[model samples]
Target chain A: MSVSITVGAYGVAFGAAAVANGFTVVQACLLSLLTFSGASQFAVVGVIGAGGSAISAIATASLLGVRNALYGVIMAPHLKVKGLKRVVAAQITIDESTGVALGQEPRGIDAMRKGFWYTGIGVFVFWNLFTLAGALGAQAMGDVRAFGLDSAVPAAFLGLIWPRLTGNFERALAVGCALFAIAMTPILPAGLPIIATAFIAIAVGLKR
Target chain B: MTVQIMTTLWIATLGTSLIAFLLKYSGHSVPERWLSHPKVQRINALIPIALLSALVAVQSFSEKSQLVIDQRVVGLSVAIVALLLKAPFPIVVLSAAISSAAVYNWL
Candidate 1:
């Protein structure tokens, strides 16, 4: 499932996007290699390309980053680190792993540990390798839109999100978010549109 | 850009990894009492969806080059068609890819 998640979600779309921009294969690969954050990367790229100052890009990226902050603090006690190990542990705190790890029965287990690291590391490795490959391969990948690779991303998104639909509220929120995002893409700064749309989705959908 | 390319990538990767490890190290500290907290549940509801929406929408729609609206649109529509028909995932994706590639190359 992690592989499935990684391939469609991270590998194809983000990798492709990284390459589509002017990022060198090495740079793209390395970026994905270390920074496991997704939205922030997108935000950073969008901000930079929009003629935004470095501070704006960083600020937008960092603002989008606060979510992981909560993950860090919440997962703090479970980590049980007292030394250098604490530093290593702190690095991988992300939305996906945190969500999965936190949902588990035990606070800490070899299984949870493996799952957390493998999913993050595995996705990271694949994402970077493919991102570079995709970047270098962009000429080869030529005209992905025709093949509807464009649609694959949003469609793949549907796969991850659709399953979580538990009620009218969730469904409504998602639809609202999607529509809002589409409407706002040309207007808002890179990160602002989607965030605004999603929260709007939450607020509006939950209203009923 | 290169600096950001270097800094943002390194910082994000290392940061995420370290945070993940620390969280993993912490393991499970969710207070049983907090398990059913209304606030926690509400926050959880909006957080991922919000994040996921941002991530997916930005990556898909934001483009660097000319936004072509031909077979790419055709391919996408067909994919939506495939979804409506409940065809297999790979088939839909591959078929769409092939169609769009053909569109770009020939027309």
Candidate 2:
């Protein structure tokens, strides 16, 4: 319950940030409703907010969403759903749900299933609610930049990625990627520099 | 002109959502071994880190086609401090916003 709420409540930041980037409240809500993945949704708004092209936004968001595909692979057999239910299951096969389900592995498959459903549904409900609240709140604020909400974009990204920098190698690679992106900012278009960093990762992976 | 921009944004928004859903659904439908290749998994694991780190940099320091060092830097610095202190997500983000706003107002 705590995990779901905590993760879901971050939707407030997303909603506000989306509006700060010029998305209408409905658009912001729709992103959360349809995309549902935090990082991918953020990439969409962030890229477009920076005046990137639609292709760039879609490319960046799809890249961030690759992990969900992996998560679905992990959960499919265990979930055992089909047809419409399979679609629903795919929608909610996110980081929190997958982690919670896996954490319950010691208890048995039944417990794991329950954990997955409860966390997924729990997060979904709270996320949409908080997103609505946040969009409305940000809309009321008028000048979001005056509140330094622009700064919130990078800060939010930092918060999301912080947990994943678990090892020295990962941390170093992140710093390198950040520097590389900064260096390429002047040369590349709005969103291309960030996408370019994927090559660095692929190179490292292949080398290893 | 405004309609054109709005139309573009709407297309991007819906298109991104569709791609995201399809990616997730494909995982369940596709054979596991296709994705479970050791090289594939290894590269996939590193992709988010690279992309997100670059995103943080790009968002924080770039404007249009130029690199910048501005109040957002001050804000991001404070955010790093808050994270180092093990602050909660909201607090980390809020502190960054507040401090950056303060800088923007006073300076």
Candidate 3:
């Protein structure tokens, strides 16, 4: 429950950031409901907020979303469902659900399935609800920048990536990617720099 | 002009949603061996780190086509400190915003 709520509550930042980026409250909610991936959802608003072309926005958001596909691969065996249930499982197969499910592996497959469902559904509910609350709150604030909500965008990004920097290699690669993107920012269009970072990862991955 | 921009945003929004769903579903449908290769897995794992770190840099320091260092840097620093101290997500984000806002207002 704590994990679900913690992850879900961050949707507030996404919601506020989306609105600050010019999306309507309904659009913010729709992104949460339909997209349901925090990082990708943030990428969408961030790219569009920066006046990026729609194709750039879509590309950036879709790239960030690739991990969910991998997660679905990991969880598919444990979640042997069909038809509508399979669709639901795919939709909720995210970092939290996969993490919680795998963490429950020591107990048994039953426990793992329960962990996945509870956490996935739990996060989905809380995330959407808080997204609404955040959108309404930011909409009422009139000027989100004055409140320094603009800072929340990068800070949220930092917070999301911080946990993943588990070792020296990951940390160094992250710094390199950040510097590269910053260097390219002045030369490239709004969303392309972030997209370009993928090549760095690809190059490093292939070299190893 | 407004309608055109809105149309673009809607297209991006729907396009992203469709892709996200397909990516997730495709994982379950595709053979595990296709994505389970070590090189593929390693690159896949690193992609989010690369994209997110770049996002942090671009969002914190850049504005449009220009690189501008402003209060957001202060905010990001505070956020880093808060994360190091193991602050919760909300605290990290709030403290960063508060510090940045204070700097913007007072300094």
Candidate 4:
């Protein structure tokens, strides 16, 4: 609950930034409700806010979201969720739920599934609730740009992704991808450069 | 929002949602042996780092279709330093937003 709430509260920044970027409060809230992934949600607004086309925003967000699929694969056998429950399980298959599930490995599969459900539902509830709060707050602000809330999107993204850089290789890989994306920004279409960074990952992965 | 903007937003959100759902479903369906392949594992691990770095770059350095270095760069840099110092997530975001507003106002 603590982890989910604390992490979910950052949706407020996203809410404010989404509105600043021209997303209606309803659209912003819907993104949180449906998309449900922090990095991907931010990527959508980040790309769209910066004037990238919807196609580009979707492409960028989808690329970041590939991980959730991998999470599903890891949890599928353990979860054994079937029928309509499978759909629900898929919806909550994010980093926290998967992490909590995996972290309970020693306690056996039932405990792991329980951890996943608790964290997943906990985050979903809090994340959506707080997203509405943030959107409403940003809407009330009226011209969030005057407050320089536009910058919050990028900064919030930085905060979300920073802890993931746990090793020298990861840090170097991130910097290299960042440079490549920046260099390509002037030449490529708005969202293509970020998508292009997938090649960097493939190259790094192949080398590994 | 105009019809165009509304259409675009719906399309993007729904498209993204569909893609995410498909990926998750495939996870349930794909064979465990195929998933356990070393190459697949490596790509999965590295992809997030690459994508996020790219996002940070484009978000901070680009505005619309043009490349424009601005106060967002300053905000990201401060956020990075704070993150390295092990500041909490909310604080990192708060500090970065503050620094960004401050720099923009200063200019």
Candidate 5:
């Protein structure tokens, strides 16, 4: 519940950012409702808002969405849903759901499944609700950036990713990827640098 | 002009959503052996850390085509330290916001 509410609340920034960038309230809400992935949704608005092509937006969003597929692989055994239920499950398979489920490892498989269902549904409900609230609020705020909300996105993201850097290799990879991306930013377009960072992981995997 | 832009936006949105759906659904379709492959596991473990780190760096420092370090970097540093100290999520967010706001106002 806490995870869902806090993370979903960040949708306010998305709402304001989306509107500030020229998306109608309806379109912003639709992005939240249909996509339901915070980072990818942000990527779409961020790219397009910066006057990049829609192709770049979609490419960036799709690149980030690839992580969900990995979460799906990790979750497949635990979920075991079939047919339409599988699709529904897949739709809600995101970072929070997967993390909550895996965090229950000490409690066994059934707890993990329960955690998955609870967190998935919980985040879905809260995320959509907050997205609407954010969209509506953005319509009223007029100038989202005068308040410095732009920084909130990266700050929140740092908080989200910081806890996961458990070991030296992970930290090193993260630093290396960050430096590589910073270097690439000058030569590549906005979205490509992010996508290019995936190669660092590939290289690390190859080395391993 | 408005209609053309809207059309492009909708198409991009739909296409992006479709790609995301397909990626999620493919997980169910892949064979167990393929998923369990050592190479796949290694890559999966590293992807999120690398991707997110890149995101943090890009979002914090990059401004359109150029990379500029600004108050957001300070905000991110404070958030990282707060997180390492095991500060609550709300506290981490609030501190970053407050600190950034202070920096923005004063400097």
Candidate 6:
């Protein structure tokens, strides 16, 4: 359950990345507090790191975040709480917390409530903690790519998606989309694949 | 810019929460017609696969992706190998991370 918070800890790393990329410490810290999704944060920072415009980077990260669309759908019933609380529930519903919440049974509500709250608070705390840590020692972190920690993001995604592989069709689709994205990575914008993934998922769903 | 940033943050929050809530809530109704068929289950399951593949491509592969490969390729390969060897997923991830670093430094 706390694994969800691990996603948050990546916040500190992201803060460091953001500062290294030229955002003020306040900007880095606030991004984590406000934005919570590590992949999108990384994607945003990666774009800036690569010298892309800030607006473009923000758009890319936000686009990449579209997967949360499906996560939202997957989580709605589990959390079961509604109205304004629905709004708060939505904030912490990232891949980790959603997975923990959705993986359970009718206890999903209990799980969602606890998991979401716990993970959300945990991430919030850790994200800021690490962000501050990272910000304080930005230079030492070096090239995140060189440390290979950047790879954890996709590895995490694989962990998030691995359970969905149930057949040849699914296997083929996952491999195909991954390969396709990889091939066009040089040309496609950062967030495009996220949209492609959702569409592809829908297409595969309909095909089935 | 603060207003814009805050607004972007709000929109992103509300927009994503609503979407995720929908995805989570949709599970409430498994759709009896679909549940009745194995074919449909097989198909329904594929959507996640497609989504995952799209993610791997976005995160791992690129237009700059080379047929010759590089650290990420090596890292992913190492992780896949670890997974096949039954390393826990986190371990697999860590191994991949380390290998990518090794590959990066190697070059």
Give the CA lDDT, 0 to 100, for residue A49 in model 4.
69
Residue B5 CA displacement from its true place in model 2, Å? 2.2
lDDT of 6 by residue, A1-208 (tens): 4454455445545665565555566666666666666666655554444334445555545544555545665666556666667766666667667765655556645765687667656765776788777666564666767777656545645655565666676677778877765565566554454445546655656654
What docking grade does candidate 4 earn? medium
Which docking band does candidate 2 fall into?
high
TM-scores for every candidate against the unseen true structure: 0.64, 0.97, 0.97, 0.93, 0.84, 0.61
Clashes of each: 33, 0, 0, 0, 0, 28
Ranking by DockQ: 2, 3, 4, 5, 6, 1
Q: What lDDT tens digits, residue by residue, belong to model 6 across residues B5-107?
A: 4454444434433333443333333443433355544444454455445655455553222333557677777766776686666576778778888878877
lDDT of 2 by residue, B1-107 (tens): 88977986898789999999999999889999888888988888888899889988888898888877888998999999999999989889999999998888889
DockQ, Cα level, model 6: 0.29
For candidate 5, give the docking quality class from DockQ: medium
Indicate the docking level reached by candidate 3. medium
Better of 1 and 4 by lDDT: 4
True contacts kept of 1: 0.21
Best by DockQ: 2
Q: Worst 10-residue stretch by lDDT in candidate 6 chain A?
A: A45-54
Total backbone clashes of candidate 2, pairs 3 or more residues apart or in separate chains: 0
Least lDDT summed over 10 consecutive residues: which range in candidate 3 chain A?
Answer: A1-10
Candidate 5 stretches with Cα past 4 Å from truth are: A13-23, A46-52, A101-113, B1-12
lDDT of 5 by residue, A1-208 (tens): 5676586657666676577566788888788777878777877776665445678778767777877887888899888999999998898889899999999989999999999998888888887777777778767866554455556666656665677688899899889988887888888876677767777788889888
Query: Candidate 1, residues B23-48: lDDT per residue as tens digits?
Result: 33433333435434555446555644
Report the lDDT tens digits of candidate 2 across residue range A1-208. 5675576558988999888888889988898888999999888888887668889889988988988999999999899999999999999989989999999999999999999999888888888888888888889988776788888888999999899899998999899999999998898888888888888999998998
Q: What would the TM-score be for candidate 3 when compared with the true structure?
A: 0.97
